[model samples]
Structure formats: structure tokens, C-alpha cells
Target chain A: MAADETAPAPRGKVTITEIARRAGVSVPTVSRVVNGRSDVSPATRARVEDLLRLHGYRKRSAALPSRAALLDLVFNDLDSPWAVEIIRGVEEAAHAAGAGTVVSAIHGRSGDAGEWMRNLRARASDGVILVTSALEPPLHEQLRILGVPLVVVDPMGSPAFDTPTIGAANWSGGLAATEHLLSLGHRRIGLIAGPPRLLCSRARFDGYRAALEAAGVAIDASLVVPGDFHPESGFTGCNTLLDLPEPPTALFAASDQMALGAIEALRRRGLRVPEDMSVVGFDDLPEVRWSAPPLTTIRQPLADMGQLAVRTVLRLARGERPDSPRVELGTELVVRASTAPPAPVL
Target chain B: MAADETAPAPRGKVTITEIARRAGVSVPTVSRVVNGRSDVSPATRARVEDLLRLHGYRKRSAALPSRAALLDLVFNDLDSPWAVEIIRGVEEAAHAAGAGTVVSAIHGRSGDAGEWMRNLRARASDGVILVTSALEPPLHEQLRILGVPLVVVDPMGSPAFDTPTIGAANWSGGLAATEHLLSLGHRRIGLIAGPPRLLCSRARFDGYRAALEAAGVAIDASLVVPGDFHPESGFTGCNTLLDLPEPPTALFAASDQMALGAIEALRRRGLRVPEDMSVVGFDDLPEVRWSAPPLTTIRQPLADMGQLAVRTVLRLARGERPDSPRVELGTELVVRASTAPPAPVL
Candidate 1:
């Protein structure tokens, strides 16, 4: 729906009355949508939401009573240890702030949005921290109407300019990992890349390319295989790269799980890590150090990111602007037994 | 405080008036404590709680409004991947039941009880599922006063008789793991035991002894090592075993993490798994299957136990008695590349 009236207030300062007038809805109807009441019809709710977004209306700070004493942490899925690390950080921070933390998983399925929204309303959570989940406009609009502060951790795509986001320096991490392998006299390096849809994944891949260019090594497109940041994909991707006419002497995986999976694949082929093929991985998860060949990977501060997200969202809930909208923590290279000079050619 | 009257109604059927009179507090004061209000003095709160427990007070079925749409999941600490597996199950089950899950970590500190109780009251959660956290009497009394349903998962010790609990057949799992080693012709086996405080740990240790007794083999105290169910202990324990004049041919660790640590220690000693010394672990965690030697472990249905705990607590929240107050799921032995017949004497 388009605005009915001429330009009124500046973006993010429009009044609720103007929004309702533009949407052709009664003030109470707009109020019902804001309160997450079920009495409003879907069509009117959608139209009102559109007007709210179109006008960039912002709820006045301190408009409502003190927010609920609970914070919500949303995820696409809760199957990985990576998530657990984040949860630990969020839980600790929230507890320290005297707020309970409600965790919800949307399962990345089509119908999960409605269920998730309902749960959000039911809990009346004060703030939200979404980890690597999409931020569709409709969902954003609903959250805005409820005046719930939100922060994104490792956002799936580029987050809204105004939304606070916390992420690791994936590009620099990828570059450092690839450079480490190159410094060890490895010219032919295969890459197991994460899904291209994620901005972080893209950055990592670009960093890999940039590192290769800096080293004067020709980029072999066939050596780079696609992965979903999961072990299974890593396994298959490694196998695919291994079958090439001339395989890479070393490998870099975008994630530690993928690196482990690649190692497994090499083992099946009767090859050993570092001795037969060197490997580097990102996200130095806790258990990687204990892996047969201690993993040499990038150390992404996952728990710290989670903790920062909670603190940022809580600050926003208190009507305070964060120092910055986006924060990228540094990643470090941890040298372990996984990387070594390529074995002498027979 | 003991009940004042000689005999009132049967246990769990006492009236609020009686409890107030017994505790020498006003009716509204008792109500405040019951509803988790902060107005009641700490001394009064404790007194009222004792009386409530003494009379075995039970809130009538359907007395409260349809309970809050949130369930609390508390853990002593959320450090291990094992906790993540349980969390996944609880989150899934709670979501399916249209309830949000609030996760809290008490960190197993001395003063965490008050903080945890405050968080629980703030959320007004409908039920609680405590995972491997001590259920001290004072904390139990507070929960009882609030009338919140509770289910214990992997209780640290034997759970209170009336409290519903979900656990695996630890003793049987331990027995089966030991027997597997024996059947593989490993006459001399070492044991890496978990903490002595937990009932599950004690049972596993007992099972190991039972297996050896059944096989007509004498227990060797020197072959047993104590571990806190962590990798560090396992590493040190393995080193201790290797220092023995005659180290056992096979080893069984009480937990998967401990088993992985033992493997690392053996690796440092230039010993190969199964070929040099066979190893078996408990809790077939997901990552174990991808470990260097693909660990042979006892599968302890951790996720299933978590799911069952949520279901049981929800049932109790609805004022329905569960099928049983305690449930122990079965465990199975998973043979991977980590175990084999003991190597013949050189």
C-alpha cells in the first residue's frame, strides 16, 4: 500500500496516526496489530504493516511499560555444537543482566514463521538475538511494531543498515588460512567453500581468491568445491576434488566440521593428514584441538559474538543506541599438526 | 517447621488456611510466596515453604489458568557437546508442544541457587526440566511452593522418589561394554570411571566389576582410574595406566570425552588404536563416529531422554500423573574402528 498523504515526518520519526490514516485502518486496528492481538484480519494487518514500513514509523522510546524480563534467542536450527557455544555465551550474559533467556528454533522451514511469531508474542520477550537466520521484511515489520530490540549474530545475508550485527572477520580469516598454506610452499590448494548465499561465505571465498592472486598461483576453478558448512558436504566435496586429473597438494575448508569430514575422506583413500595432504580449517571449534591430527584453523570468537549480541540488544531495549551498528571481531590462525610442507615428490 | 494440627486432610489435600496457620503467617503472605511474589520476607518465605512441604500440599488440577506457554530447562553448566544434544531434543519437543523453552545455567556454584530461583520466578515458567543439576532440598521446596512441575534428566544422584526422572541404563551399558572387551579375548582391562557422586557413574563402575566377576577374573585395583568425566582426567588417567609395570590390554572410559582423551594420550605414546590397545567409551556422541579411529561406545539415547523429560514435565503441569515417576531408557553398544581383539604378545 502506498502512502495516502504527502511526506510527513522524517524517516523513523513518523507518528502512528499518520501510518493508520495512510493504511485506511482505524487507530484501534493498528494498535491491535502492534499488540499482537489475533482479532485483526490478515489483509488489514498486512496493509497496516506496509504503511508502517513505508512511513518508517518508529515507536517512541519508553512508550510502553518496562519490557519483559526475558530475552529471546532465535536460530535456524539447534543441531550443532557451534550453536551450543553461542548459547552458553548468551545464557551467561543474560543471566548476569538478571533477564531470563528463551531459546527458539525456527527449523528453517516454510511454516515456521507463524509459529515462531506466535511464540514470540506468547513469551512477550523484551529483546531478540537471531543467529545466522534470515531477516525478512515482514518479520522485521512485526518485530518493529512490537518495539522489540533485535541484534543479529553472523547474519545470514547483509543485515539492515540500522540493525546491530556481530560477526567474525571471515575474509581476513580465509586469507590468513590460505596464506599460511601458501607460506608452507603449497601452490596447488583446494578449497571446500561454504554456501554462497551467506555473505560471510562469499567473503571467505573471495579472500581465498585474493590470497591465491597475491601468491601468483593460478586459480583452478575445478579445485574449489561447494559445501553447505556441514560435514557431509565436506566429505563429498573432498572426494570430488580428489578425483580430479591433478589434485591440490593442500586443502582449506570454510568450517572445522568440513575439515574433519575432508580428513575422513582422505583416510578412506588411505591418505594421512599433513603427511600425504595438508589441511586448514576455519572456526577452531573446541574439539578440533583433540582431533587425531590437531586442526590448524582460524579461531573465530563465536562465544564472544553471542555475548556481544545479547549486550547490544539489551542496550537497544533500554532506548540507547549502540556505538556501532556492525561489529566484526578479529580471527586468528592457530597452527597445529594439520598443516605442513607438501611431501617431497617421488 | 512441622505441621501444627494433629491430623488434617490426607497429604497433598491440605488447605492454604492450614499452611498459613501452621507457619504463623497471614493468608496473603502465604499466597505471596506461592505466587512467587517478592513481598514476603526471606525468613517467612522459608517458613511457609517448609509448611507447604510438610503437608505435601498440591495445587488442585486445572486450578491455575492455562499455564504460561514457557518451559524452563536448567543445566549445571553448558560446556559439553552432550549438553547440546540434550538441548536439541528439549527445544524440539517444547516447540512441538507450542511452548517456548527458557534455558538457564546455574554454573554449579554455591550461590547459584538464589539466582536460578529468581530467574525461574521472573519467567513464571510453567514447568522445569533440570539436567544433571543437584536437586537440593531448599531448592526443591521453593519449586514446590510455586507449584511448578519438574522432571530431572540424568540426575546427579538418585532422584527424590516423587520426582519424575529420565536416564539411560548406565549399569547395563557399562556391563555390555566390558563384556565386549572380554569377548574380544581381553582378559586384562582398565577402567576410566566417572565422578563418584553421580549415581550413573557408580552404576557403571559396578557394572564393570560385575562383568569381570562373571568372567571369573579378579579385579585389579591398579587398573582402575578416577575421572571427572572430562578429557583432561582421561588423558592423565591413561598416562597413569601406561606407567604401570603391566598396563591392561583394553580400556573402558565412563564417558566419550574421557575415551577421546585416552586416545590422545596413547597417540603421544606412539600406540595405535585397536592394533596396540583397544578402547571403548560411553555415550555415543555424534562426533565420536568421526573421531580418528571411530570410537566404539555405548549409545546412551541422550536426546530421547531429554525429549521424554519435557513430555513428562508438561504432563505434570497439566495436573496429570505420568505413567511412572522414574524411567530409564535402554543403551546399546556401537562397534566402530576403535575396538578389536587384543594384539598377540610380541
Candidate 2:
């Protein structure tokens, strides 16, 4: 370390000019690296990156390059309507911010991250809003080195401590859904839990357990079944609970898709929703309201979370600290026709 | 017009240098006008635009401006699952081609077009795919002047004949749906038509009439009702049909959302689908498969259309003529549980 140079350096927020001065390069060279151009040498790129990290340099909101402002939104897959809701939210908010939204689905968790990264580097995106957890650690570091602002929506696990994240109140949503069922006088409530790997899913499961314990109802290990948050898993989970020696009268699915699946499963067994069995779902997606027996659900503000992600990322891009780095939007329980009092015990 | 300069102009695509020479301006000035940069004087912009339009200047597939390749997808509104399906398709195809997709909803037909246009001008988008007919002729002309490639998906009314468009076989879908009901021994089939303003909707309605004619079933005008292709309209249309002195045995809704609405209306009236009144829908959106008595409907190749739009726009951007200026993909009838032989006349 150059002690004299370090002593003269500002305490925080170094500019490209200062970085270039320290790296013995021109201002344009620093600009090229900052803009993610391919012309920089590997050694120089490394040195600049080290200094950038050391100084925590954040590019101030200078006049953007001649190109349009773009916000990249990445997802693991775009197959579900859930993804659509988030896209709508992000698109709306990004548009409001005078930024175009670039949407990408990386197929699976991590397989296409490299391709996406290459594309990201190729484009001068203003910021990145990650709606999926597929990107690995090195990519995150690369983004940081590039000085790109990032906001994660519904982060799967413990993201970097400083990474700003937006998510629904999964735990509270789960608890409220279960509590709604309990209030309807159902003691034996089947729990269709989302994938255990996801933090949101785990939080929801914890909420379900908390609700059950709060009501002084014994947790029946046999009644809880795991799901991957798809309708197929929900169907399978519902059947698993139904085949048990003692079946719960009402069931709560961690996702609307799963709830729809569970309802279909019950239908196949010649049972009626709310009559033969009561069902509750999470993520009150639009179509669920028109669902047969109209689903009772926990409404995750998916679009709001998406909108907030864009706002937070833009704030970071402007070199402003957000009031909260991690925000969990409140979730609410919506009672429709799906849940009802348990049928008179035989 | 500069006659002496015009004499030597190329007969086909003009280069930016040639345009600059003809316009008596710097190459960068003409380039700015082409790139939608607002810095150029209005008078200079008009002169450059006229020369470019006269010469049919197309930005050749040279190295793009060092920004990410982006294909803009615009819709009147992003409220429907139909939009989501299309978005998924476009996003997938754009990803495959190493291009990013920028999605925007103009809100209504034309309310937000100016804002979108401003954003579009501020960005270096490679191509545009219009999913709505909202953008007016002036905007279209502006996009043309900017040399941005354009494609239309499910265009409403008659778009400019030169504009390449992608759509589903709406007439065939409608014909097939109505014929299926006729084959199911139901002579009285209600038709829930989409807004007549859209050409696709008109085509579907025409096919419905043609099917009835082919079956020698006099089309009862009273049985057909107009809808805005929403669930609420479908519900209202279904109720209207049911109140007739002689109600139809089955109904075909123009879109899946309307079909869901119709089903909900029936549920409210305590009428079971298929057993009481058979129902069919258009646009077999993904979630409809999980709908109660899973909707039997015509499946519009929405995603396929979206994918084709991306390919077509990219091709136009490359200055290649597509095989067809207007292409309609086939729509197939998916026979699920919603349609069955109408219950024996009581």
C-alpha cells in the first residue's frame, strides 16, 4: 500500500479520476472499465478492481452514456404466472423511472448465469434486479467490482449481509393463512409446505408451526407434506395427507398453484371443496379469485416487491443509502369461498 | 432538393456518410438524428429524415453502438395472463438470440405512447414488437424515420400492410370450437365474442357464424353477445344467455379469462359445468388446465407468436425480408373436462 497516497485519498466515494490517477491510467481507461468495455487488459482490470473494492467506489449519477437507461430483471424460469406479476411490477416502476426493463430467464438455477453475465457486460445496464437466486457468489462479486447496483427479490437464502432484498412477509402470511383456517374451527389442518431450501418457504413453514402452537394444537408430523411450490407437488402432498389414517379436514397450500392442485386432487377423489374439504392457498394471484370455490389465500404483494426492487436499485445507482437494505412487504389473508367450518364430525 | 447531389445517390440502402453528404451536415449530426438523439435542430432533423426516407436508409448490421441489443415489446395493457404467455415467449426467444427484451405497457390504447416513445428515443433499441394497435401513425412514422425495425403481434384492425404481423388462426379456432359443440349434439350454443374492434375477434366471430351455417343450425342472433375479453364481461354475457327464454346448451368464450368468469357465474347460479351447461374458451392459458373441470378451449399459440415476433423483428433489423409479411399460426382445440355432451334435455 502507498501510505502517502492513501493518506491523501478521500475517506469515502472515490471518483474515476482518482482511481485512474492511482492506477497510473487515463480517465477514459477508468471509464472504459467502469462501463464494462472489453478493451482493458487483464492486469490493469484486476488492479482497478482491487482499488475500486478497496475504496468502495460507487459511480455517481453522471449523465448516462448515449444509450437508454436499462434495468435488467433476471429469473431462474419464466414459466409461472407468478413471474408475470413480478415482471409487470418491475416494468411499471422502471418505466416510471425512465428506464427500460430487460427481462431474462436463466433456465435453471445456475446453468445460464455465465451467458447472462456476458450479456449484462455487453450492455450498459443501469442496474440489475435479481428475481431469482440462481446467480452464484463470484457473479455477485463481479457485479460489485463493476460498481453495478443490485436488488434481490425474494432471495432464496441468506444473501450477502449488505445486499438489499425485497420479499413478502412469508412468515406472517403463512401464520395468517393457518390462523384463518383455525378460526373456522378446523383442528386438524394439513400443511402443504413450499420447498424447504427457499428462505421464504422456510419462513412460511415456521409461521404455520407458530400458528399451530399458538392455538395449543398438537403438531401432527404426518399431516405436513413437502411441495416444490408447483401444483403437481400440491396435488401429491394433498393425496399423501388424504391417504393417512386420519386426514385433516382443511388444508393450507404454500402457493396458489399448489392449492389449485390440491383442489384438483380432492376433485379426483370425488370430494367437493369447502364441503368435503376446505382449502387455503398462498399468493392470491388474479385467477385464483375466479377459481372454483374461489381460493382463500395469503396475498403476497409480488408486484409491490418488484416495484420496490427497482426503486431500491435506482436509489443505489444514485449513490444514496436506502432506509432499509432488506424490506419485507406485508402480506395479508384474503378470505374467499374456499375455507369453511369443518363438517359435522360423523 | 439538391439535384446535383441526388444524381449520384445509390438506388438502394444509403449509408450514413451519404446521408450526411446529401444533408450537408457532419456524419455525427446525421447519426444523431438516426439514433433519435434530440440534440439536432428541428430543421436539420426534418431534412435528414426526408433524405433518409427517400433513400430508404437502413442501419446495416454493422457493429452496434456499444450497448446491449434490446428488442422492445409493447402492449396496450399487461393485465391478462395472455400477455404473460406472450412475454414468456418473447423473453425466451430474445434470450436465445443474445438480445434483451424491453417490455412496456402503454396502459390504455394510446395514453402512454408518448412517454414510451420518449423512452424509446432515449435508448438504442435494436427492434420493436408491438402487441397492441395503440401506437398511432405518427409514432409509427417516427420509428420508421429512426430506422428501427418493427413487427406487430395480434394487431387490432388493419395495420399498415407492410408491417409484418404474427397472429393465431382465430377464425379456425372459433370454427373448430363451435363445430365441436355441434358434434356434441348441441344445436344451441351461445357465443361469447371478443371486442369486434380487433380483427382477430371479428375473425373468430365470423368462424362461429360459418360453423353454425355449415351445421344447418340457424344462428340465433340473440344467443351471441359482445365481450371485452375479460372475466367480468364473460360473466355478464353468460348471465345474459341464461336469462333467455330458451338458453343455449353450451357456450364458447373468446378468451380463457372470460371462460373462467362464465364458469364462476354458473357456480354462483348453482349450475355445474358440462353436466348442466357445457363451456369452451379461447386462449388455453397455462392455468386453465388446472381450472375446475379443466377448461376445454382453443389454444392460441401466443408464446409461439411472441417468439416469431422477435425473430421477425431481428430479421427486419438485418434488412432481410421475411417469407411472409403477415403470418398466422394455427390454433388448436384442447379437449379437456369443460366440454362434454350436453345433459339430456329435461
Candidate 3:
């Protein structure tokens, strides 16, 4: 059963069962010997060992038992300061763990996925953190078989399959945002909704509806304008709501970028914030603090989500399973100058 | 004198002349054979060929003659939207070229240089685009010797070595920014500068001073508060200027970020932009267009700089020298709502 030095054998093609069949031994015996478990008899161990070496079969742990040197970070786009904040958190975590990071923008796979995947494998990245879980299943399987760890942040569409994820309590964030406006005596509140396809978007939207339902306020379709969580979308959404016969007295944008856009739209129409309309935004990005009138926002721990993703993926890379499949961090309400009580009735 | 397979033969270490000596041929004969240049006798060619193969000596073209698949982008830091604009431009250009990009932030080295350099080598990046030219000489030589192409954007200190570089007309940008503020009929103008070590900062500062001198206004050191090109710095600079016994009626910030900071500082102190004081900024970042009152600033064509850097580095990777060692694109002043004639004296 001695193996030839140059047998031209390759791994990843043959499974443990196949090896067991070839060796005329049980699958457990083959596995035991391959893992150096030592429970197998000497004769069987030698036979299985020779077969394993000849076939170039190596367990996932055997290929890279040590920690990986670099982490792969994939994003839907790199256009927003939101991405920068996430990058900052991930970089900080990666730095602390003594690992380097590589960032890729897939943009819904516009054929960039093939190139990015090739580079990831070539780089032998220790793990991967995908900011948006808008990926095809086949690609997920491909990465799984290659033994590269993966973690998702703010999954889009539906929940990903068995992939650990880290995200903010977006529903709670939405609820708290609406409640803040309600406490300030805002009954006629308008909402700029995020993308409908994303689960986080739906959760936040649902939470907003729940708050209104609890307040005994009737749902007004005209007050809810759809947006893509961008400035232009927010601007358009706000303008649409403002054009209504009886416009909302207070507006809640799903994102800070969108809120800023809404503010711009309001100003262009010769309206003032708080005095004319109160606005509250989500994701309390740093730039929002410098926005005119400042910004009252729901603070989603975007950086924490990034840091948590790194930690989760690193754990997976170390061959350890995460404690939970999904981890939701808390959100906070930051009241600044953008929000105020509705103007006194004329 | 033929090399043995296990002779510890370093591929890049041995010289062609050494191969010639071993092959019993003239230096010219060896050179011609290695370069695949004809006109060498078959007998000599056969001898030199055998020696070349034995020693593992191959031309540079023999290795990765194809264009690289990944481009490395290094930044001093990635905290600014300015970086995002540049990234957008480079990513677009790189996508067009079917090349992938990897971004890194050095934070003034922080000992991350070794990790970054190692990653670059392992990935065999086709080229490198450095946002700042503050790299150490040894690291520069290492990249050059490894045949990795390099380009610099907005060189921080000065023009780098033979490496091709892309930069903005920073002096013109500065002059234009200050000139806009001066045109508003303001004699005492505050200046918030960027990092002093960067060449771009020095140029802009010089331009601001020149604009004042040209207007026959004496410079006031107290009115010129130094800043590090961030929002907080701008806020502090504006506050410091506001505290001066003789305050300026207008301000010119070195970057859009600083301008935003100045606006925030003004708003926090119960002041209004343009109505209270005119303001001008350099680097018309995308966010600046959405800033309240928009912004009147110099447009640096940051995205174009990114695109040009990729084209330049790709050319270098193709073994072609650029038309010039340094290329400075133009900067234009964009008149937005932020600048207005100073309020009539009380």
C-alpha cells in the first residue's frame, strides 16, 4: 500500500467514502486514520494512510490550520460615507487581530463576481464579510466547499442560508424613531421608505407601521413615499409627499443621506426645518451632525456591526461555530436640532 | 560551470554574463539568445540555451507578460468622502479595463507597510496607485525592482521618482477659492489650512496669501487659524476666528470638509452662511453639492484624477513610459449659493 512519490494524484475530487471504498475499509476507519485518531488497527491505518497520501486528500482543517492572513470585505457599492464607517470598524477589528483586509464592490454581480472570486481564492483570504447578502446560492456553495469562512451584515432580500449575520435591531430603530416624533406631538408623520427588497428595509417599515397602529393613527398611503436610501431618492420622495393636498407636518427618512436630501428638497421649496416641518433620520452618520439644523436620528451601530462581522468570520476561520446564526445589536435615538414639535395650529 | 537544479540558484540573482562564461560564449551571444534575438550560431545558441535552462534565467517578459488582474490603491487614510469620489473614478476606470482594485490605508505607515507590501507581492498586483507620495525610499525601490507599476495622486510632499504621477492644479484651486471670497468685497478673510506637510496644502495656503496681497489687504495671522482639513478643525478654526477682536467677514477653507465644519460652527453659534459671512472651499466633493446653500468652491476633478491614475499605471505595467513624469489636471471654480456679496456695512 506504499504510495508513489509522483502519483499525479489530486485532492478535492474524491470524498472520504470513496477513499474507504477504494481501501475496502469502513468510512469511520478512513476518517479516524486521516485525522490521526489512532483508533484504527495498524494494518488498516497503513492502508488508509497510503490511499490518503496517494489521492492527495486533505481535510479542511489540514489545508489551513493556522489563522488566515487577510480578510475579504465585499460591498454592494462604495459611494456612501456609510461604507466608509463600516470600513473603519472592520479595519480596526482586522488590525487588532493582526490580519489585513481586501475590499471589493460587486454591484449586484455585474460580472464582477467572477473576477472578485478568482482574486479571493488566489489571495487565500482567511474569511469574507459581505455587507449585503444579495448573492446567488451557487456562489455561496462554491465558497463553502473551498473552506473560506463568511459573515453577512444587513442581509438583503431574504435571510441567507446558514451564514452567520450581524446587524442592528432595525425594527426597534424604526419604532424608536417614530416614537420620538410622536412624543414631540407629531401625529401626521410621513415616512421615506428604504428599498423594499431588503429584509432590514421591510423590518424598519413594519416597525414604523406598528408604532402608528399603537398610537391609534390611521395609515395614510399618501404620507409614505418609497425611496432607495439615497439622497436623490429621498429628495424625490420628500417632494412627492410635499405635493400632496395636505402634506405631512413631520417626516422620517429611513437613512441620514435620504433625510439630508429631504431637507434639500424642503429648502428648495422655501420651507424651513422644525418651524415648517420636523425631520428625523436613521443611521446617524458623522456627516449628519454637520448638516444644517444638525439631525435627530436613530443611531444604528454600523461600525459595531462591521466589527462583529470580522469577529464572527474570524471565529469561523478558526474552525469554530458562532454562538448564534444571527446577532442583532441595539440601536439608540439621538435627538439633535432637526426635530421639534409641529408648529402651533393657526 | 552549469548550474545544478539544487545549486541554490537564485533566479533573479545570477547575471547573463555568468551564463555566457559557463556556456563558453561571448557576452553578446548570450544576450541575443536570452532576448530571443536572432543572428546567433545554432551551436552557440544550443550551448547558451542549455546553460540558461540549467540556471533558470528568463527575461522579465517571460514572467506575467499578461496585464495584471488587480490594481493596488494605497491611501494615507480613507475617512473622507474625497477618498470615496476618487475611489469611484478609479473603480469605474478599472472596471472598464477589466481589472480589479484593492484599497489600503497606511495611516502614515503605523507599521502596516510590511503587511501591505507582502499582500501586494502575493497578489502580484498589476500596478499600484498611491494617493500620497510619502512612502519610504526602500519600499519604493522594492516595488520597482519587482516590476510592479506605480502612480501617485495628489503627491503630498513633492514629485516622486521616475514613477508616473497624477495631481490637481492645487495652486490654481487655492487661488480661485480665495479670489471668490475676495470678490465678495471682504478684506479680512479667515483661512483654514490642510495638513502643512502636504505640498498641496502649502500651495493653497500660498495662493490664499497671494490673493490677499493682490487685493492690497494686509494679512492677519490671528485671522488665519491652521486646520487639518477635517470638519472639527474647520469648526475650531471658525470659532477661533470669530473670537478675534477684528473678525473676518469671509473665510476660505482648504477642503470641502473644512467648509462643512465652518458651516456647522456658524450654525451652532447662531450665525447663518453667506448672510453672516461669505465662504469658499477647495475640492468640490460630491457631498458639497448637497451642502446647505450648496457650496461655492474649486472643483478638483477628483474622480478624473482617479481615472487618469489607473490609465497611467496600466500604461506603465505594459512597459510604456508616460508622456511626462507628472500630469496636473485643471481645477475650476464652481459658483454656488454659499458665496454672496458681504452684507452692507451697518
Those runs of model 3 whose alpha carbons end farther than 4 Å from true positions after fitting are A1-70, A118-126, B1-68, B122-126, B145-147, B215-218
Q: In candidate 1, how many Å is residue A321 off?
A: 1.5
The residue pairs found clashing in candidate 3 are none
A1-346: candidate 1 lDDT, tens digit per residue: 9864466455545666767877887877887776668999999988887776555455432222222378899988887769988999999999889888888788888488877886776566778999999756788867876667889999878865478889999999999999999999999999999999998999899989999999999999999999998888888999999999999999999999999899889988988888889999999888888887789999999989988988998888766689889899999999999999999998
In model 2, state the lDDT of residue A181. Answer: 90
> A99 in model 1: Cα distance from truth in Å?
1.1
Q: Which runs in model 1 stand beyond 4 Å of their true positions?
A: A1-33, A36-68, B1-31, B35-68
Q: Between prediction 1 and prediction 2, which has the larger lDDT?
A: 2
Rank the candidate models, highest lDDT first.
2, 1, 3
What tens-digit string does per-residue lDDT give for candidate 3 at A183-227? Answer: 999999999999998888888888889999999998898899999
Give the candidate number with the greatest lDDT: 2
lDDT of each: 0.85, 0.86, 0.79
Model 1 chain A scores worst on lDDT over the 10 consecutive residues at A59-68
lDDT of 3 at A166: 86
Tens-digit lDDT track of model 2 for A126-240: 7899885657889988888876788899999979647898888999998999999999999999999988889988999999999999999999999999999889999899999
Show the lowest summed lDDT stretch of 10 residues, model 3 chain B: B59-68
Off by over 4 Å in 2: A1-18, A27-47, A50-66, A109-111, B1-18, B22-24, B28-32, B35-47, B50-66, B109-111
Write one digit per residue (lDDT tens) for candidate 3, span B231-294: 8899899999999887888999998888999998898787888899888888887777777878
